[model samples]
Target: MKMALSIALLVVMTSSAGAQYLGNYSANPYAPNSTGNAYGAGSPYNPNSVNNPYGRYGSTHSNSSANNPYAMDAPKLYDSQGNYRGRLSSNPYDPDSISNPYGRYGSRFSPDSVNNPFGAGNPYVPDSPTNPYGQGFSIQGADDD
Candidate 1:
């Protein structure tokens, strides 16, 4: 009975230890060995990888609430430094916002930065007669006799 009791205690302690993490940490900065705690946020892209397009970690707000590319409907806005800016509806991606210098898009690509004053959703537009609104609907003028 004594042996069984000790073994059970040991198992319980180890299990709990594995699920524990160091204190004094927030989900803002992510850590490789810092799991079990929901306090760390992952870098927008693999900061360690050479192919990683995101700028230097912690330099461009990697912990931003709007930079969740892992989410179901993540936006594709990246800054000049290649850091994730934010979504179109978000401030960082909005031309009206003081933070958005490149306009709607986070990058310099014309297609992503163009602002559509006459549309909704994503104001970034081609504005051509063939396809003025990328995803937004269009309006027709009344016919005259």
Candidate 2:
């Protein structure tokens, strides 16, 4: 009985030690150990390869004013650094008659054409064809007409 107890304790201790090292026993079967193109850890593409177009990563918007390819004077609002703000409809009071009504840094892009004469939601265009003014339907030659 004493011998059997000692053997059992030794087996339990040895099994516990082996179980502790189970995680480190083998290389990860899920992860490939060696490949033809070994470029360190989580590299999807060949790091040393020259033609890795998708692998390139860097900030391109550093010098916007200089590197800007499509930099042109838009008919809408803009800022000092040539950034769009809002459309011409952003500002209601001051009219950007000749120049852009909205500031340069405007997000919207509404041309100061026949769209919004008075404001965005309302244009003072005549409802009727003969009525050059915006009035409701009336008689041919009525007094209110």
Candidate 3:
């Protein structure tokens, strides 16, 4: 009985740890690892998908949308080691978005911007999502939840 309990505990712990990172695929449509199918993460039909223009997280009018420049809360990027990087937004007008070419964290000339080939955007950087040839990083949801 003790051995069985220990095995169960180990399984639970391992699953919990795995949940913290996005896998190659996930059941949660909001997860970055989800497929882009109709009910998947990047699906335009998925109500919770960031690709859904009318969804809460994707609507241009929504306060939490990545398309909203004034959005106070956007999905965050993190290194494989779980270090907070910056907001993962496509809004070029958003000051905190990596897509903003003039923003401090988004500028191609900035060391922190992913557009900087020699910096965080380097494809050789193990923690960079732009590093398609490397291990890559994680895209975590907003902490405000």
Candidate 4:
């Protein structure tokens, strides 16, 4: 019985660890380093930011998939004016997302919006459920110290 309890405890711990929000840096090379799992300043949930542990997803970039080989099927594109350009044909967040796997909302993962900073006029609208900052963050006077 003791052995079974230990095994169960181990499983629980492991499962929780997997669920921890660590961002998706190492998982997707094509993604910017800002939204990755690295812990530090400029991170979306830097404990210092208005939104602590800024969940795991945030704003996306327009040129993220430019040179990406898996740029296809990532997200539709657009110009600064929000014009519909085209859709990505590659899968950046698949489980096999090795090298350039797609992230949660099909947009390249970033640790937070601060680090990545998706410029204005991004045209990719995430069809998935993980896109939190697709429209971008606009906290006026947020920096008024």
Candidate 5:
């Protein structure tokens, strides 16, 4: 009897581990991180939100999906029913998320990412044509202290 109990407990725990990710867009649907509230600064679907320990599955029409400007260039993925599954890598809760494989919403995955921080509008990029302060800095309030 003890062995049977241990086996059952192990099965449950193991299944939950694979479901560590969170979001409606997750490939796995065992335990969806479902929420009626809109995704944003403090909602479940918000990729920037943390501590989501379950499966993910976001819809394309979700508030966060429609509002976040970052999704403009990011790739989009969908489910069988085609219900706006979610952006390619927009979930921040799942570290191993297929959508967010590198996690951090791909914070360092692309040229525009903070890790690289260089592109059309990066002010720090001296060679970028859109850099407003490329080679010059006036230090507007340096002496405010």
Candidate 6:
């Protein structure tokens, strides 16, 4: 029984670690009309809603806010296959933000950055939002509706 229990614990630990490396498997916060989008604003009073200026995730003064430069919990972006892309932030100072031109995932020269015309930003890529001629693009993260 002891041996079985140990094996089970090991399995659980391994799975949890793997999931973390792959990124949080949550709904796409960047999706059009999503709570994170300015256009798809959620309840104006919901703490996590970007529409709430006083909310933790919405307040510019909060460390976890998407608008905060020091935010550590900015909404993450994931591809349709659940691949971890990066943080979906407009803060130019956040190292993980896709808007940071100097960051790995945000650099226009970086292959993973959406600003890279030859890479993730390519208009020909179906998943690229820059692809105006293609179907709508999608990503994952943020508070549930």
Give the whole-model CA lDDT for all candidates, comma-separated: 0.30, 0.25, 0.62, 0.30, 0.32, 0.60
**Candidate 1 structure lDDT:** 0.30
Candidate 3: C-alpha RMSD after superposition:
6.7
User: Against the true structure, candidate 4 has what lDDT?
Assistant: 0.30
Off by over 4 Å in 3: 1-40, 91-95, 133-136, 143-145
Query: Which candidate leads in lDDT?
Result: 3
Which residue pairs in candidate 1 have backbone atoms (N, alpha carbon, C) closer than 3 angstroms, thus clashing? 26-39, 27-39, 27-40
lDDT of 1 by residue, 1-145 (tens): 9999999999987666531111111111233312112332232343321112362221223322122232222223333233333342234544422235566443334333323233222334332111323222111111111
Which lDDT tens digits does candidate 3 get at residues 4-69?
999999998766654222221122334345533344456777665666799776788887666677
The digit string of per-residue lDDT tens for model 6 on 12-75 reads: 8766554222122122345543443444434456555645678765677876565677677676
TM per prediction: 0.18, 0.15, 0.61, 0.22, 0.24, 0.57
Over all chains combined, what TM-score does candidate 5 have? 0.24
The per-residue C-alpha lDDT of model 5 at residue 132 equals 38
CA RMSD, predictions in order: 21.0, 32.8, 6.7, 15.4, 18.7, 6.2
**Candidate 1, after superposition: displacement of residue 1 in Å?**
53
- TM-score of candidate 3 versus the correct structure, residues matched by position: 0.61
* Model 2: CA > 4 A from native: 19-145
User: Going through the candidates in order, what is the number of backbone clashes in each?
Assistant: 3, 13, 0, 17, 11, 4
Stretches of candidate 1 off by over 4 Å are: 1-64, 67-86, 89-99, 103-109, 117-145
| Better TM-score candidate (2, 4) | 4
